[model samples]
Target: MSARLEVADIFRRHGEAYRQAHHGHLGRVERRVMSAIELCRTAALGGHIEECRACGAVRVAYNSCRNRHCPKCQTAVARDWLAARASELLPVPYFHVVFTLPAEIAAVAFQNKAVVYTILFRTAAETLRTIAADPRHLGAEIGLIAVLHSWGQTLTYHPHLHCIVPGGGPSPDGSRWISCRPGFFLAVRVLSRLFRRLFLEALRVAFEAGGLQFFGSIADLAGPAAFARLLAAARRRDWVVYAKPPFGGPEQVLAYLGRYTHRVAIANSRLVSLADGKVTFRWRDYRHGRKTKLMTLKADEFIRRFLLHTLPDGFHRIRHYGFLANGRRVARLASCRQLLAVRAPETAFRAEPVTDLPSLTHPCPCCGSPMITLAVWHHGQAPPPRSAWNDSS
Candidate 1:
């Protein structure tokens, strides 16, 4: 049987060529991403040996790269993250809202990622809060969790925020929980207009403070007149703010969060093949009835598109705002539960105990018994010989 293909496979096979072709253009983050994905779960990074306590069956487990952008590394990370979030789910209905930038602004964002992405998160959250707080609307403070996704189905650079918000929040007077109208959240038009104005204003401020940078095709924007024109053109367009129907309940919201929170540019399962100097992958064409289609690109182009979504060092892609903001979350949640007369869900996550041989999360394949680590090795070191264990790579 043929081994499964992964993003790591593509990087290991064609990465050096891609690096050579685009050496002048690649950034530090992109280079590191390529290297991490290529070396992930490989002997170069080292591994440990485990034995079933009952049957003595042996297994070899590798260390993960744990790079946020590596597709192979996010599944376990997302699972752990969602487990921590399970207890935070409220009993109220939740809404999924998205705020997307206009193409002109997205072009500017591609060059100034750290500044523009931060602006995107802040303005989007502010718009939601401002609109929901209006007496004419819900008139209550709402809490939301926003996640940033920078790639489209075809791996194009499409920057947007996916926000999950509860149906309501504590009233301004703190007397009661104010629920939104049944089957309705804030108006999309209001949200879009507010988001656009706030974002453009923020961009103008950043430019004035010399916080944004431009290069290559957009180098002309370094001039004040050209930059002003770019903002003016963006202002003339209607920004997109989409609000999907409210989720059935908190359970559905958790499932949805699990899928979106730690997604990379593309999952390994999407790759159909890589052959003859081209890479083929599956993508959903949402504009065309949500049909699944095959897209093939030159190997270099495929690598380029994959690296386009690499985030800057220490940049956060997930954030909480309003009542869910980090510092006040525990207190606000306690107050919210009291208002709603519901108990918080029991937390499902517990910190694993530390020891010389850490416990493995998985059980032995042959005997279904607990597996205990027998030996460990660091990078550049080889594990002890175990004839029973097969190397999958």
Candidate 2:
């Protein structure tokens, strides 16, 4: 029942040429990703290997890559993650904020992914914390779960941070839980201005500390004046900081995280066709309210686009800070929950939200209406033995 066009499909078609083109220059991660994708659902990794009882249909089931970049493998990963995080969800409102670099800065970031992207995360976090802690604002310590995304739907380099934030936070003394206004979380305009200033400041520091390198057309930026001019040009353009209303509740926040936390440059569900050495797929046009549409690209072009999002070795895309910080998360979370006076609710966190909700709003694709949950799937296993088949058969 998998409708996905997985990495295995692409690798089966073109991994050999790609490996040949890179050869010894290939990093361990890229090689591993390629190998995993190639072997994903084939007979290489053992599984149930189901066959239809009535028909002669046969299928091979194998293990997943579990590589963070593999789109087809994110569902279970997201569900497991959500289950673990469900305990940490406070009853307070949660907001979604996005910080995006201007095109000029993004160009430089594309060249120095690890360094520039790390700086982007730091500067954005600092900007939010500083602004939120000011006496004029809520004046409390904030927390965030920031996920970095490096590509647009078409796999272009579009680095941005997607933050899932609790609407308020513990006061500096930890006495009370501060809450933001019902609708307004933070000011996008202020966040944008401050983010631009802080990021440029951090970039200058990185350049002076010999953290940046330039080649090709950008080589001239090695000079302070050239870099200053670049920064000034970027400053003249508007940096975008978009903040949306609070996600309705914990369930909604988990649902949102499930989608974004493990997402890759593209997903299997988006691929439409592969024929005649060309690939066709769907992508979102964010510039126009995310109108969905289809696009076609040469096979080589498609591979190139996919490779554009290959992250630097050992970089962590998903991060937790403040209350969710690894060292402090447990204790702080307990205190926060106590302050909020609401215990985390118990639910089927491992199930997909669409499946959990009543199907009236989202009709089943197979039936065009609500579908009953006939069963729950366990990992690499079957449902409990049915009575009729237990002894009679």
Candidate 3:
């Protein structure tokens, strides 16, 4: 049912030694991630037992860790989340925009994730709002959904914001919905300049207010002179901001983000091999037209690179801003519907009772009858003697 190497195999084989070697250095959250991946889908996490009706067959389904960083757990989670937002889709063109951190700033962010990443989110949102509201542009309040990604194809610490935006927005007075030109959203050059200014200014505030810290090579930045120099260097660098062609419909936006929102540093399908304490995987080198290439790294080194992307616990990686803000989303969306001359979604699509929904369980393999759950298995339980049953965590 599966092909290619997986990250789970790597963890199951080498996790204990890696944990012991870095015992004192690993953070609590990192430790939790390791445990979750190692125990995922194994008897260590237990299983669900279902018996067939006519054929008298039995099925055992193991529990998943459901950790945010687990590759195997994201598909179902993404589907459920996207379904919830399906009714919110306005029949408007959508755009995809990316705001990235400059290399010098990225170096600092590599150390201070919580503080710097928060600033990245706030400033990117502010830049979009400011530019879209200018008379030279659309001159309306815009709304966007942004997801944070901290790694690049090569698994380097490259932090960037991926934003799915409507081509236009509601007027400041909320009287009408504004639409941008057919093929253009906003100029990437303009977005880049504005985003750089706002982000650097915010970074300066964070630095002066003692909200940031310097470590290792950047430790000299603890002094005011060094910090100023670093800021000046980052200012001279060109920050990257780009927008893709407008999407045909709102569902396009949902489909695009469903693939992005829940991914980790890498997926198991990309893994090629693990042998001689070295791991090989596939990656895309964007500098060369995104050609696929294989990369090899020591097992410990690969683990280190993976851990670099772990976010501060409880941080919400996906965010909504402007017209889409939760406080007024319903009213704002209602106004958009009126302006666009689209009727409200039918009751079947909105606020339908859960009990009326179709069942999610699997059917009997032979008889097509809905299988009944026989027992709930908990981790660490001593199994009662039974034939044809083996503990599969």
RMSD of each: 3.2, 7.6, 3.6
When summed lDDT is taken over every stretch of 10 residues in candidate 2, the lowest stretch is 384-393
Best prediction by TM-score: 1
Tens digits of lDDT, candidate 3, 1-393? 656677788887888888999998888888888889888888778876776665777777788999998778888778767776777777778889999998888999988899999999999999899999997988989988899999998788899999988888888887888899998988888889888888889989998999998878889988999888987887788889989888877657776877799889999889989999999999998899999999999888888888889888999899989878778888877888888889865422233224432222467877887665565677876433355343332
TM-score per prediction, in order, is 0.94, 0.82, 0.91
> Could you tell me the lDDT of residue 362 within candidate 2?
28
**Comparison by TM-score, 1 against 3, better one:** 1
Error of 3 at 6 (Å): 1.8
- Per-model CA lDDT versus the true structure: 0.90, 0.78, 0.83
The reply for model 2, stretches above 4 Å from the true place, is: 1-4, 19-28, 44-60, 350-393
The window of 10 residues in a row where model 1 has the poorest summed lDDT is: 348-357
Better of 1 and 3 by lDDT: 1
Model 1 RMSD in angstroms: 3.2
Q: Where does model 3 exceed 4 Å of error? A: 1-4, 345-360, 365-367, 387-393
lDDT of 2: 0.78
